[model samples]
Target: MISNGVSGNKYMDGPDQVVPSDTYISCVPGGHVKLRQTSRGLASEPPISVPGLLKRTAARYPDGPALVTKKADGKWHYTTYKQYQERVRTVAKGFLKLGLERYHSVCILGFNSEEWYLADLGVIHAGGYAAGIYTTNSAEACYHCLESSRANICAVQDKKQLEKILSVRSRLKHLKAIVQWEEPVDTSVPGVYSWAQLMEMGAAEPDTQLDDILKSISVNECCTLVYTSGTVGPPKAVMLSHDNLTWDAFVIGEQVGDVKPTVDKIITFLPLSHVAAQVVDIYTTLSNAVAVYFAKPDALKGSLVETLREVRPTRFLAVPRVWEKMYEKIMAVGAQNSGLKKNIALWAKDKGMKHHLARMNGQNGTTCGFKLARTLVFNKVHETLGLDKCSTFVTAAAPLSADIKKFFLSLDMPIMEAFGMSEASGAHTLSIYPRFRPESSGLILEGTETKFGGAVSPHGPGEIMMRGRHIFMGYLNDEAKTREAIDDEGWLHSGDVGRLDTNNLLYITGRIKELLITAGGENIAPVLIEQQVQAELIHIGYAVLIGDRRKFLSILITLKSKVNNDTGEPLDELDTETAKWVAGLGSKAKTVSEIVNTKDPAVHKAIEEAITRANKHAISNAQKIQKFAVLPKDFSNHTGELGPTLKIKRNVVYEKYKDIIEDLYKE
Candidate 1:
């Protein structure tokens, strides 16, 4: 009953095929056999719940490391699969002892942590829906989720997250108990219990009781509520069932290939609040018994290099911004080099690119020049970036620049880009290995049916509708939004504009809600223009297109600082090389504001050049950005302008800078 939506476009796959109780939009060219074969895995595997998967993995690999966390002393704490299973069971029993009813929502607010994940798994095993909240969410955003979910039990990592809940605790009519993971918590506060106390209480509960509850929990019952990224509006809770989560958890690897247990290393660094991360890190790990390393939220920036050196993960998953920052750092290093080293760096990069191009064309015998270039440049770069053995780098949750993808590919890193939304369970499309289509989202996932709507054509992109086993149950408590998103035909309207090529490669153009129509009737996809600008402009953090119904398009841009973009370090924390690079650009600003807000000629010129490049790709004059303003600060999750996954909240930005946007039209 799940679908992406139907397409009537000429490019529709296999021509209006009648799927039982659903209409398929199109099939990928030559996708029929592979797609059908891959779809069989969903049923081939025995149905299992989250707890059942954990038990299975634990039984198979009792002594193998399941969870890993690093400490301040550069020591790693390992939890074996058996231990993890026991901990999860103990925690689930704690939920029962805490008076959590069946199918009740339990919100877990925090960053990536052992306890955070344990609580989530435990909640579901106890037959409660676990709604994860981003650590960076504002108190109001926190209140919205807590109130709407009607959660009785909430687990927080520290006082900061606890206070956000406490600030609006009065509004949570059903919330009764709060569990704090870290110390220094005033347990004197009514209903505030420490992690130890909860574990103790859980241990006291009968193990038999928890087992019976897990048995009673139906696959179709809601067990998790994932909130949308809320790019265009307020976040809505997407209700997904045990079946919705577990079905893909079991079958996801079929499309991406197997995730070898204990052999492939993976770092669980992304926010667990996001569905993509949950699917990739949690379910994937459990399904294949993959060892997961957890990076402390506060120490992530300082620890990533050390961990990467130590773990040398075979697989890594990240958003586009992470890769972009990595590219920026590499560029910054090159900028600091001079003379022979600089020339060699340039030459090596060129050769690497040439090698990639040749390999992509199915040339196995690369020239000596490419091998030498890789030895001289790409190899060293890979070592420094701790990507030496990272066979695959999976990117999703936002648009990834092809330039970035190519850059990694040149360095012999497989940068596989994927596209999906919260409603899609995890992903709609994931690039197949070895044959990457640049700028495409990849072929449709197995068992997923896709189509285009709203005046779409073979050549023109349209809203992508998908139906598949991967789709979610519905929006939590919001029947109207649910109905609007999923049609009667059971297709999930993706709200994303995309087109499939003859090769069946899916190229995502933009979001339907984000398309800007000019006064002259020219419809433009802002994401396309933004990506173009970002690609052309060095030191650009993000570019927001600003023409909804105006005469012409304009853009608001944020500049990158010398500090590491991933860590969000202060200006004073800039590295020596980066600092010198910034100073060389005639930037004397100390703070974020002084740097971005200052009238620097270099920044202005860079943006102008970027705009010029972006205009080249515009289909019409209206699609081109006529004016641009450089903002002092970038959109972030803390700033309420970015979703948990770092997708821009266009409406929030538009409203926050309404005056600034209006000023652009004045002159």
Candidate 2:
């Protein structure tokens, strides 16, 4: 506990327990591996309360650019730390005036924004629990949260969120009011007020009343109900305490380079509903005093390049989709360049790879060749991607390919892959310097105890079991399910199938519940196979491997492949075979839809060849995909085929294509 803030705790189920803070034995392939957390989350304990953390940061850097947002006309709006503090105070007062009692739940449904920030912190400051609903959730999903959390009030961002709330308004007997950042279109809804009106109403209320409530709040009290995305199943609400959040902020700071108040900057675009984004971008940023730029929801899709160029964040984190597009674009530009430029680029890429390897070997020195490559190659590469200032670029919420990780490291913009879930505030493990394992999810963080246990019968990796302060209290309002998650031994069953390497590095193999057992009695993890497809195949937006209790493995491939898997670049021109194939499909173009319904010769050859290549890595015939069917459209959040983080909604997709799935096994 000297530095890591984790006291010695035994991991075994027996009575005799004397395990140390930085020592735990993990199961590896053939022998036991030792794991430790030498570094601490914070050098010293952080502030106990979320509001107290904000106030201290404000006092230190009152004039610093705190909350930033770009306007409709393209001009940037800055909300200084001082202004941010004042607004949070005012909003807290408003909550008090509206009769929000201690531990009252308030739902904030929206994308990231300044108002959303105020509403979230204000609820905590006023001693209320804040729950966030994803902007991508349907009315039914939103309703479930509203009823489950028993939120007395809702602060929705726009009409879209409001419409969902209204859809189930009659069922929310506990909801007393609704406040909105955007102007309400319909004035007929009772107990609804515009943000301006709410603030004005609170302006007449006494500030001391809210102050007393904030001061009495304990660190162990529930602060937020962070719900899981439920990519493979129904969502569950995780109750994370104030201590849980404040500690994670410090852990994140220690893991990556710390978020500095006047120095660091980041533009947040991930859904506020997700634990990772909320903890890192909002709570962690506020606690560390980092500047946060809130990207407009509409502009999020198209303005990434422009925003990155303008903000040039010192610390950046994104989901896999963003990283994929950036990597593809850079690779494309390098391919399209002329003779001199292309030669220089390729030479630089080679040198950069060596530089990365050197770093991975724990050597800090850059060779003379790498220095020249940096001068000619990497510096420009960073600028083009608006990553010149980025010291840490993290990818989480979904598994990132090892190839993508290496590509950025070659550019000197290392992508730190991390793993976590809402059940545990934000992160449990991360790949960092000196201990970097691009293929694995890195070592366990301070205070977290994870061990593999209860593998599905005798085959495959065991399910991950974790017990730590980073873990949540329990599932909200569902005691039966809560007990099912965290056992009597205090371990929170992760339900993910994984293994710890001899070096303590964690590799997530699959979801225990999502495993597919074939007719041959061979157990297979679909996600692992899906990852292989993504890495090996061209134009694969998503891959759904289906072979549970079936004769052999077959897959559904959603294609919109941007580049050829072999070259990492777009086809110079369609090959004669593919062109002829397209001709047969009655389309004169090479596109996803054009090839989706046709037996286009080139498309067939490409997919078949890709499948054959993927099969080389398979351990058994049951693991290899024997056949695949193409989907016309890519999985999307709007269509409810994907979760907020872009993970496939397995049940929804299966239901949508029941007929197609039936036909696949017909022969």
Candidate 3:
């Protein structure tokens, strides 16, 4: 037997409970399970089911906009909280009416949109797991996710996604029906339903069956599945419980103060298949009653700024690549300025940087100089980027470069860095503005515990171990991997190596698997050296180190190049910013082939000087890049050199450039 728990209330486990340890207690509904127990919890808010939280938010903000969408009519539309809740109920009932079984899964494939959110929550409401597939995934990848999750129903955004599902439909024995949200779907295929048909089916079914399923819901049961990106190995299905989603969202909002209902809004375009987007764009918005506006399908191609201008959201979260692109665009445009305008802009940027740095160090930053700069230069930049109203700017999913951070700070827009993975639901350590340190992952969430494992001291560059109510249930259908991730002590061992400062802020160094060991027994984190090279050479987009067990380090570099708008494939032509920099180098080369085939002397000398300058900052000779080669083209998602979150796949890069790496190390 186990006692029910409320906010801040403590209860003891009975004989039936299988608590993981004495330090932690089980707060999950029903009998306490072994691996799901946690030592830390939020004292201010009670645990809630996903659907229950939606219902409460609807009651509190009935008329407030829950979802704002722009249709093909070229106009914005609003769905109030009350109506959003009603539609969710209708979809949930429809799922049950169409034979959705308890604990089964519904696979959703699409970009972020209203129908996507409805399907995600509706599946959870009807006692099924909602699994999202990356819109960039191939049909084979989709089949793997659907099979791993045991999906019975599939919901897709458009005909393109529907085609992929249909290609794999025959092999999936459990799949019963397919629902296409976007029209022009060939519904001539049997067992394929339209969005209108789904609603109509819900209208015909009674709510009693859905209500009964809701009554049997438990906060500890898995409601969603996040499949890993499989950069190194096969993707694992990350099982997230209802409590994990609700509790994580609550703490995230609490950390980001002043997130009031109907006031704060967010524009979400990041892939919802990732845990960060689901936590920030969906659950957190629901918890705070914050309005969410969906970006256009082609937002990443070139239209993201247009959407940002229209929405002007209060909070913005993006991966580092997005911010880097924005920085490059601004620099390209600034290059066109001349004379007094350029001088004024540079002066303003200097003042802005000094002002923010003063404030970051707890000094008084308000002065006439800063005020003038804000009015003259910083405000214009904000207006151009439509970030005038955005108070919180966050960067996550991968490590951000020091140069990029400094650039943003010079514009008086400090982008806070956050750290988390799918196993932790979403954010574990967050850096809110004013409370954030430069290059740190901010403070750990209030109800989470963190420690450095296998370290000689408390603050160490060791494996990060964390435990909290926000911890995920387990990997779906992989008990061995689950046990390996979370030990008997209930601490989820993150493979990331990091150190904590005296202020309790986290600074991630590198991943254990990504570490390089030299012949003389020196361990080096490649990212630091790679980032230094890129910082010194502003025209390069990627600098990948090529030493793991060798005597010294070498690198593979790529010049900044244009990418295919439709497929994200890297093109040989230099980008506008890079081309301008190249022209300034006294070279007439335009494409990467021109630079490589002709062995441009000016460009080669610049790269050598940049590397020599970068090596001056290296900790030791072994860590310094001894040799380097410029790749023919840049790395990108289409080439499988980068992951979905724009993180470099080191193994893939090494394999692709093995000959170049060998030539560098040849005696």
Which predicted model would earn the best TM-score? 3
Error of 1 at 94 (Å): 0.9
Better of 1 and 3 by lDDT: 3
Find the candidate with the highest lDDT and give its number: 3
Residues 382-446 of candidate 3 have per-residue lDDT tens digits of: 98998999999999898888778888888989998889999999889998766667678767888
Candidate 3 accuracy as TM-score: 0.93
- In order, the Cα lDDT scores of the candidates are 0.74, 0.74, 0.84
Model 2: lDDT of residue 654: 84
Q: Write the per-residue lDDT of candidate 1 for residues 13-55, one digit (tens) a residue.
A: 2111211213222111111110111335454444555766787
Per-residue lDDT of candidate 2, residues 1-667 (tens digit): 1122332221321111122323221111001111222255442353366777788789988999889887778788899898998999898888877777666678999878988899999888887788999877778888888877777888998887888898899998888888878865455678777899778877778887876676466554567888887653577777776666877777777777545667798989888888999889887787777899876574335567777888888888899888987876676566569899888887888888887788778788875588898999888888877889988888899887787787777777778877888877888888776577677877677667887776342323587877665677666655566667766566677778888887677898888667888998887989777777777753566789988889999999875533344323333344343344445545566666556656556666777888898899898877999988877666666666777876677888888887778888997
Q: What is the lDDT, from 0 to 100, of the residue 244 in candidate 3?
A: 83
Off by over 4 Å in 3: 1-44, 455-461
Residue 170 lDDT in candidate 3 = 93
Descending-TM-score candidate ranking: 3, 1, 2
Clash number for each model: 12, 1, 0
